[model samples]
Target: MPLSDIVRALNAPATGKRPDFLYRSGLDHPFVAAEGRVFIHYANIRLESKFLPVVDTRSGRTHGHASTIQAFGLSNSVPMSPDAVFVLPTDAEEFVYLDRLVRTLHALNYLTQPVRGNLLLRVHSRHIISVPANHGLAFEEILRPCGLLPEQITLEINTDAVADKEHFIRAVASYRSRGYGIAISHFGRTELDFPFLSQLRPDIVKLDNLLLASGRPLDRIIDNIHELGGRILIEGIDSANLRRNASSLAIDLVQAHAPILRPSGIRIRRNADGGEQLDAAA
Candidate 1:
């Protein structure tokens, strides 16, 4: 069936009284029934311009004016809104660039106001050049003035980047002090020590795709995290089977990007084990 037909069918009233438009599109990204409500992923790019006679690597020559471009496919998500879309960066440098871009976009009136929900930005460990401790403070400075609520915005940090117990705790504490939500992305990727993670008490924890793909027993893990007062988001779920499995585990959230365009509709039901399920309707 065509994409429009699939969306139309999914939105039909028969698919349960509650909202039926929730569907997975490309990977683990969720999308509403309407296209306008979907979020887009963007990468950061840097352009350098210098007025000097310098050798060009590509042209193998010198010139009075030269420009260099550096770009990385750092993943970030931004929801569509009347105002300018606020994007979160994957690293400190990207965050810097994003801060400038957001200001420019806002000043130019290219983005409409009032702004929507706070954008969640990812921070990679490699982005910290020296004082990793200052990263959270820097992020708060960049976002607080943008009219984003502390709880509405989240800073996503990979578990690997926070290898140091003391540093991780401090960083999380600093952000929490600023009223910003701290999230640990890609949780359960490795057997890293999580004693501090539980202690620091981040608001969100994104479960690793590995665990979702493995189809392992996750009830205990989910229950434990919930008990610790952390919201869990499961990623990389691409099939009904995986969705069923995740729902059975009672994962707080499941991201699916595939099968949305398919004929099947989003099914929010319960598995035989009495756990929640998110998959295409049979």
Candidate 2:
């Protein structure tokens, strides 16, 4: 759809009370989100790139719920728009729309700090603007206009969804050249590991604690990342024991209800045990 059309669709007047989390960005994309200086903090753990939000998915795993307006904006009825919007590199125009979206978010950063530690806030590579071989100067256009320094952002690649290797590698390098942090996440228990890490050299590799095992090659992987000057994140940690084992293997960071939420009585420390709440420092 044309950008003007999307904006017009969103700009149309509402019929009822709008949901607090609902945002009509005057774009075709309708998103449900919190307003005003909201940030999701990622614990630096062993490493320090602190600002990373998936789709701006946000800080420290502190998830919340927001309902869409019953009668306003995009839809005249229920279900609102879909909860998520996926962009494809089908055409240059897609990137054109995305470019505007990201730049607007970058401008919003001026009203709020986008950094937490040494890391940058995570964003996606849709519209080919984030993909190097396909970017076609999109990269050049984004950072400069967004007024974002390389240090405050991390571009994310869904590990399970990668379709092209050569082009993706080039994409990683392209962003890396400009100082963007790269993180590969949503890694699962399967053995379909990324063999190109040695070549791509992502800043962080995330794995699920559910996939932790007696003979998994996690140690070897950790060693490889350490050699490359990168770090590992263990997600899906639900227990103290799981966190304990992850810490034993030297997992750099984690995301789970227990770790993210400050346990009332636990002494938060970065030690042999699973450390304190990450947001504690922030």
Candidate 3:
């Protein structure tokens, strides 16, 4: 189906009120089509999706694309860091609504093309904590209308700040049970974290670029992750040397800063309106 038609279909009013847990009061379809791409409008905020390629070192091919959103203030057109949106003083329900909205926006924009590889999505830790049960159920429902399967998505969660390890483990298990892949973002550097990681058994372990720069030996950590059947992804890779190190270290996935700035095959129409400024480059 055409993207315009899909937008129309998605925006059409439902026969009954949507569940309050899914959206705030008076919120409807927030999606807009621009230059063949999708942007979302919500409460004086505008969001656009960017897909960063996660390259496979061995084949030198993109193994998957990680979905990231760039946010801007709708009133002043000033850019806001992606993390700023989550810091608002919103209730749990509203936060869940906002978090799921962003993920849905990414999913819709990505599914518009017949692309290879799974979609890597970063889930706010607060969003995980807000839900009392059934972690992936709501997001899975959101993906259903877009023809996206839970197996096609990997949820990246930053686990370092999680105060409740038990809750975190259960949440990861719930997501996995629903066919979603799990990735522990910015994973710890020490061997102590490895036992819990082994217990959790995530599909991917993402290391911060700073960890590699620290000159600490990651050999044991890498071996432990591999032994537990998890792949390693190094995030925020910025230089040629870092890329070379990633290959030499047997890293399975790498996310670079430069390639993320380039367009990943989606074209925005030149005629975007509604005070939403968008780049027309593809």
lDDT of 1 at 45: 24
Report the C-alpha lDDT of model 2 over 137-220, residue by residue, as the tens digit: 344343443344665555556545556767767877777887767777655545445576667788776665545644466777
Q: What's the lDDT for all of these models?
A: 0.44, 0.43, 0.76
lDDT of 3 by residue, 1-282 (tens): 676666655665463323233455577777788888888888788889888778888888888888888776787666666777777636878788888888888888997655658889988898888888899998887777677899999999888756888888899999999999999887864324876787788999998656776778888878888999999998655445656677677789987442222233233222111122335343
Tell me how many clashing residue pairs each candidate has: 6, 11, 2
In model 2, where do residues sit more than 4 Å from their true spots?
1-83, 87-92, 99-111, 118-140, 192-194, 213-217, 236-239, 256-282
Point to the candidate with the largest lDDT: 3
- TM-score order of candidates, best first? 3, 2, 1
The clash number for model 3 is 2
**CA RMSD of each candidate after superposition:** 19.9, 11.9, 6.4
As for candidate 1, its clashing pairs are 24-257, 25-257, 26-257, 27-257, 83-112, 84-111
Candidate 3 local distance difference test against the native: 0.76
Better of 1 and 3 by TM-score: 3
- The alpha-carbon deviation from the true structure for residue 3 of candidate 2, after best TM-score superposition, in angstroms, is 23
